[model samples]
Target: MACSIMVTAKQFFGDPITCITDEIPQKVMDTYCWIQSTFTLPHQLDRVAGEEVAHDGVGSYVDGQHEKKYHKYYQWVVFMLFFQAMCFYVPHYLWKIWESNRVRNLVSDLNNPILEDEKKTKQLKSLTMYLKDNFRFHKWYAARFFICEMLNFVNVVVQIWLVDRFLDYEFSNYGTEVLSFTEMDSEYRTDPMTRIFPKVTKCIFHKYGASGSIQTFDSLCILPLNIINEKIYIILWFWYMFLAVVTGFSIIYRCILCSSPQFRLQTLRMRNRIVDFHILESVFNHGDIGDWFLFLLLARNIDQLTYRQLIEQLDVSITKKTDRESFTISMDNERESKDEVGMLKIEKVDDFKKF
Candidate 1:
């Protein structure tokens, strides 16, 4: 969308104004020809021929010719802008597909509160078992996630290269240039022309077959569009660089988190502390953390051997609590019976025992 907006602005408002005149006076052409004649020697025909060849080889010494080349690739620049934006979004689309198929279904089953306690426990146990048995799937998912992040980094790098290649100068160096804050003076740093776009340029046009002679016309023009392109690319260059840096860190963090045993241990300790694990189903169902949780689930599966140990510990804690409750209930029942019997006996046996 941003790319589209920039392209539109360039087409309508960024076009350069061309210089116009009623006609080139005959006196001006006569004077130009006289000046040209003075710079040449008709007697030295070979020398003049060699000089013309050299001049052509050196390519358009006039400023107008040089500026003409700048506008030639404007179409290519706009095409790349839209292409780069689409490339950056590819990873996100892949993640969405994975989330919809696998993560959402699992979270839904786990979070269904209407299910009987035994069925819910069975479901959790089955999920844990599945995770333990399918360790390879976890590793594969982690690798896929890492690849997606690296793709983002690659997209940014490619975009930076494209900008430099097309602009062919320090114009695309805004990312690095912005770092040297202390070295740059205020006027150059703040100059709109320097940062916004290239405005003033010379353009040359040829009038052909005019009285069987070619005439060259040069004029100064303003390319308002180059300014818009400059500003858009400068911001895009830095934004992509920052995104790549963040993605690199996230990949590292995910690798470490998934590979370590600590994460599983932490999950085990925190599992029972959750009052409503079902509420977290919605969180895993959507949002940024959903992908992370999917990876975590896969990681747990990979270490099923160790994860089963945590499950055993959980089972032991549940059994101990159930036993304690049952013993307390039995003691309470026995005490109540004893009190009722003693009251019905009228205390005759208590007096005999004291004697």
Candidate 2:
């Protein structure tokens, strides 16, 4: 994920962004770019992020020492299941609200071809047109939504079961290790504190890998736990992939809906402004794409990761162009000031001064 994001940032920023830490596997990058280009974001629109202005530095150190340590959430799995159940109720409520809104607008204007002078009437017309064009789209949307909800419910159950089993097995093995220590010669025990040492050592090895006093122990003792962890990891991969597919689909759907020229223009304008602000902020902050990338990488590494982490990682890359950033910010601010004073204004190309 980190490598993919770095590639994206490099494309967007129009400069080199290194993977000094190699936090992301090369195979993962290959799969990510292939899947993203094949099934999700096309290369054409992907160019937009590359053209945007970047923050001050393209690559820098990522500090994560202050970040919270990853913790398992065996209990939160129940809430995930509950949340999926609640989603079943949401669509119906949303349908009622949408129907009422539509009805209210229709009642206010009986004429089929309403006057364009009324803003509310124009909105109703737009809504009608949008619905007419998208009704078929809605059916597929609802079907996908329901399928995802049901899958989430099933996943929550499976995740909770698997995680709990893994934890129990881990602790059971630790208990065996502790018991074995007692069997060894008392002289070899070294100290009373060493009794608690094995568990702490185990966790440290899991995170940092034979570093700084918590070196690897006998492989025979850890082989079973390592095998169990690997199985748990395989299940986690599919879960992560499912989440990524769903999120990528959602981004695609949104792009589809916003493909209209007006919407794209507005989105482009808005994106430009955000990049500008970040770059100005970056001049003083000196933070680079790595800060954002690292945050996302850590988030992805957590036990129950979400696609939003990946999205955010890509967002930094996609929005890395500095020129677009400055232009957008300036244009938006200009438009905002004009709107604030109740005077209609459209900016001319000459209004922007070259830096």
Candidate 3:
């Protein structure tokens, strides 16, 4: 937002374009050229200034003979910057809605170390119970958050490409060309900034003569705005590339960490040394992918000591629950075995009577 505001202030409040003309009123010519847009002669930029073209990108628009590269998006630069800024928040917004406050409910105010002991213990127990009961139900919840992260990576990539398109495919090489320009001999070098964003261009205004014949007026226009534009884009080009690389790598690492349980276990241990390794492994083994993901999130949000206690409590609760289930299944099997023995004895007695 700040970036957009700055660009907007300089581009609009300042005179974006100035035209030299005696035939047309100065203000009228400036506004007309700015609104209608201006074009540069691409072929003339390479020619020697004094011997060929009078100035860089300066020459005749004779019968529209020269290949023209119109300065199209200078007027829309701020709006584009604003759009880019807004796109970055889209994933965050989706996650906010998708999250549904599940994390908040689980984390509660437990992270606050100054809480009353009784209230804190009560909340901790409640959190443990919730995790114990809700196991295996939150796969989509954790997965959805990761999907939003993937969207964030995608957003970065899209904005990079969008800027390239906005600059007529010049943005991809803008930074590189600028950096390498000094290596070339001065006689052979052309400024990439000027090529992508020209300070001077031409605009044609048409009118009718007193005799009613069509008359054409050509004007040489100066754009001081491109100075600001070149600097802004060079900074942005490097920023976007760096951001893209980091975000992309982060997404790949997350995908690998989530896919491999060993990596997840190692990460948990690395983050929380107080938690028992055996407990972590036991709970992690029994739980599905989503459970570990949510647990990891809780570890980040909750206070360290509290999180250790919470993990211990969860381990105890799961252990008891599993033991009860095992006992019930064993008792049922024993009862079935006794019933089978009784049925066999009854059948023996009936066979003995028949004999």
- lDDT of all predictions: 0.52, 0.35, 0.88
Residue 237, model 3, lDDT: 92
Task: Candidate 2: give its CA RMSD in angstroms.
Answer: 29.3
Per-model TM values vs. the true structure = 0.55, 0.20, 0.91
Sorted on lDDT, best first, the list reads 3, 1, 2
Best by lDDT: 3
lDDT of 1 by residue, 257-309 (tens): 55664553345335443323343332222223323345356434433433343
Q: List the residue pairs that clash in candidate 3.
A: none
Q: Model 3 Cα displacement at 213 (Å)? A: 1.6
Worst 10 residues of 2 by lDDT: 197-206
> lDDT, candidate 3, residue 66?
62
Error of 3 at 9 (Å): 1.1
